[model samples]
Target: MKLPSPLYTTQYGKAYVGDSLELLDCLSDNSVNLVITSPPFALQRQKEYGNKSQEDYVDWLAVFAKKIKRVIKNDGSFVLDLGGAYEKGRPTRSLYNYKILIKFCEDLGFFLAEEFFWFNPSKLPSPIEWVNKRKIRAKDAVNTIWWFSKSEYPKADIKKVLTPYSERMKQLLKNSEKFYTPKKRPSGHDISKEFGNGNGNGGAIPPNLLQISNSESNSKYLRFCKIANIQGHPARFPRQLPEFFIKFLTDPGDVVLDIFAGSNTTGEAAEGHGRKWLAFEKEKDYLAASSFRFLENNKSDSEIQGFYGALLSEKEVEIRSKQSALIFK
Candidate 1:
């Protein structure tokens, strides 16, 4: 079968605005170094992007996973961020989306490496059916990130990604340095040691449980959605979240793929971090917003002016310049 074409190379990187499955099929096998994405949640509310039945949702998402498996390098990793769903007006934590995805990946021959929780302490509270109907309280939060690999051994540098120790931790390490010092080595043997005080090293290497706020007011994402005249996708992740993974998992110039690129947070984060990025969004409105945001965030003033000169009439440019100045002020 024929595949899609890669498009639009920028200083930040290249991004394809189209269907994810078709785009993945286009990529060369083992071409991608990392895959990070947050797909649409199977929620009851009306999603700005396409929404389907829960069964269809899982099946549709599986097709993208299959393609991801094809393109990811043998030692590469995949990170999927999913949220749990409720069923029959009850708080069913058992119906986790990650479970189905994990099973699907395992069946498709991907190794299940690790699972992390993006714990949002700022999550909205979900009302309980029993209490609301005159009984108890229901749970609120709903997001999980799953990490998978193409092989048993993946390319991750844990030491390079360690979070630095805090001031108190540094002091403790200083106090305990003598204890960590090695005793006399055997004759002619080269002995070296790596040690720390172990008193809370900058939040313990960023635990699988991540606690981040999800407030969206005045965010660049909201601004881009407004400018593009698109209804914002409800499940957009914070840029910092994906940025951490990009920094920790991949090196500069490595290819990063987000098959279910939702609002393209992974692409934005990858660009900011000097990594090559590929994102796929099926919805046209989302594609437009993602493209505009990616370009706008990465453009310099001179570049923006050049674009204005080429695309806008003199009167329109003057109006736009005034608006831009007003925004900066």
Candidate 2:
């Protein structure tokens, strides 16, 4: 399918500025390998980035989910990140995210592959009334991440996203025969002698819960945005979040997409991992500022200004890694 002209193009992806549903329409059926994104959450108070009220969010999202399902390959996965919200004037939590999971599976034809949770250690104390003032509830720092797939068995490899083994596990691997014994425990699971047999892969399979910090103070994207005097996306996710799923769910050269690309972090992660990517966002400033991700590191401030100026003028800019050349169309 031929897509509309993009606001800018990187070597591996195109960042389009328009309604995501419109961009999603241009994609051929079963074209994308993965769709990983954190759309605007259903929050009580509206954020600068915009969010829907809890009541209207699920139906609002289903419109796009249907198109997303059509574009994703049979073995492809849809990973959604939704933050929890509090009910208005009460300490009670909202179930909008859970409702979305049910609506997508029961109403749409998606399978609930697996559920993951993202715990941001740097997240501030929220719902000030309940957590800070009343001291009745703990800080809500976890976001529910639902992994939906068109097929029961999606294209995923945990080996690609393994976490480093702990020091105790490292020691056990080194002296399995001397320090360990094979025995059946009270839990009724028998431990075999080959339990420590990792074959020197150097990592263990990660758990469903992901612990990643969202601190972006020193990131190049933020630095460039500051230099260019453009406001960086306020709710930018850490690249690690998308990088994990991209590596786990897709092979090199496969297509990955983000329907609501904030700073185009998913696109940047896809580019680094050698995957073709597409990003769609309605905000022009955010989409244009995302071009900073593809810019050459050693570019001068004036060059950065000129590049951003061209994008603001609505000229098509193509970024090539070779000599950090900019090709205008």
Candidate 3:
């Protein structure tokens, strides 16, 4: 499908600047292999990038859910990462995130493929009234990641996202006979002798609890934003988050999308993984700063300024790869 003129282009993707709903409407049905995004949370306090209040968040997000369902492939997946919120002025937690899951599955005809929690080890203590000052609650460090699929069996491969085996598991693999024998436990599941022989699997299957730190203090994107005197997107997810889903859910040539492409991190991940991607963000400054992700690191300060200057001045700037970076026509 022909999309609008992109704010910037990379070898693997294009980043668009506009309302996501309007941009998504331009796509054809079953065109996307995966849609992974982290929308603005329904925070108690409003942020500069903009966010809906808790009461209106579910209905607001449902509108996009319908559009996403129409565009995604039959076996495709929609992965949503939502940060938890507390009730206004109270210490009570809000149920907006869970509500979105139930609404999408029960009302929007999506299946709950699985649920995952992203544990941000570097997350700060939040809602100072309750957590930091009053000391009534623990730090809110985990974001609920809902994996929704149009079909019961979505395209996924656990092997693609396996973690390295622990040291003990390596020892067991090397000396299976010395360690123990396979047997049934109180759990009532029978352990086969095949467990003794190394299955030749590269790593162990990872758990649903994903441990990633949100540390991007000195990335190229941030450096560019600093040079341009632009404020960076505040809630940028680590690139690993998108890389995980892209590997597990889609092949190299499949299309991946991020509806709320703050700083276009998903696009960068998709590019690195050889997937065609589309990023939609409403803020032009954020999209402009994201172009730095695709540029070669050796670019000088003057050259970088010239590139960014064109992005700001021109109606649309085609950001060709370093091999063809100067080709505007």
Candidate 4:
């Protein structure tokens, strides 16, 4: 399959509206530096955007996994963001996410680089029948983010994704405490004297738990969609989710891809970090509206209309040639 013409392009990224499998086949082997995406969950019920039922989810996703393995460099990574789902009419949560992880590692010959937990505090109480009405369970807010690698050592720099120091640690640095007498802790662990001082870096290594809120009401993208009478993507990953991985797993000028870019948030984040990116989306309306995230807030209506027209235009021009009766190309 030939790589289709880009529907739209920014200074740092390209967005294609079509089957990702076709677009991915056009790339050279080991060309992508990182692959990051939050695919649709295999849920009990069918979603409007699209998703297979839980029974077929793992196999459906494995097809893409094999393609990802071929295009990623030996030191590159493939990060997946999958949320837990519930079994139909049952109180138990599904293990479909784990099933996919196993398929990636054991069957596809990939390695488990690390596991991350994304905690969305603003998530509404889910499985309403089991949690709200029955009062038998708590709110489900944590999602499993599995990071897989093609080799033992993937391209990861935790320093890039470090968080700010805690208040206590910041206070210690202000006190000029360079050395603490080494001693055994109450938990029977030895403490180092350098622990009193900072690691000399501005930020500390972040834990595996990522705290992010997905709620957005006043963003420019949403505002444009409301006025244009278009629905924004129902499931949009927080910009910071892909931003963190792109910074940690890749360097400037490296290529990144999002095969299932529902709203092209991954492209926006990659562009922000000086990385070139490619985004593939199947839904045309969502892809057209996703361009809003790339435009300035002061863009006029005509500019917005032109932006949409440029993406939708398939004007045909017929030429008279000796070898052809009629041609539209």
Per-candidate TM-score against the hidden true structure: 0.76, 0.96, 0.95, 0.90
> Which is the leading candidate under TM-score?
2
Give model 2's TM-score versus the native structure: 0.96
Report, for every candidate in turn, its global Cα lDDT versus the true structure: 0.66, 0.92, 0.89, 0.84
Q: How many pairs of residues in model 2 come into backbone collision?
A: 0
lDDT tens readout by residue for model 2, 1-329 = 56779999887899999899888989999999999999999998889999999999999999999999999999999999999998899889999999999999999999999999999999999779999999999999999999999999999999899898788777777876677776888997776544557455658889999999998896778888888888899999999999999999999999999999989999999999999999999999999999888887888898888888899899999999777799888
Candidate 3: lDDT of 247? 98
Model 4 poorest ten-residue lDDT run: 315-324
User: What TM-score does structure 1 among the candidates reach?
Assistant: 0.76
Candidate 2: lDDT of 152?
98
User: Per-residue lDDT of 82-190 in model 4, one digit per residue for the tens?
Assistant: 9999899999989999999999999999999999999999999988998899989898999999999999999999889889988777766555345344578899786
Steric clashes per prediction:
3, 0, 0, 0
Q: After superposition, how far is residue 117 of candidate 2 from its true place, in Å?
A: 0.3
Candidate 1 lDDT by residue in tens digits, 86-132: 66565554464765656666678888777788877777665446435
Residue 127, candidate 1: alpha-carbon lDDT: 44
Give the poorly placed runs of model 2, Cα more than 4 Å off: 186-189, 193-201
Ranking by lDDT: 2, 3, 4, 1
Q: Is candidate 3 or candidate 4 better by TM-score?
A: 3
lDDT of 3 by residue, 151-175 (tens): 9999999999999988887877777
Error of 1 at 138 (Å): 4.7
**Stretches of candidate 1 exceeding 4 Å from the true structure:** 1-8, 94-98, 127-135, 177-204, 224-231, 295-329
Q: What's the C-alpha lDDT at position 174 in model 2?
A: 82
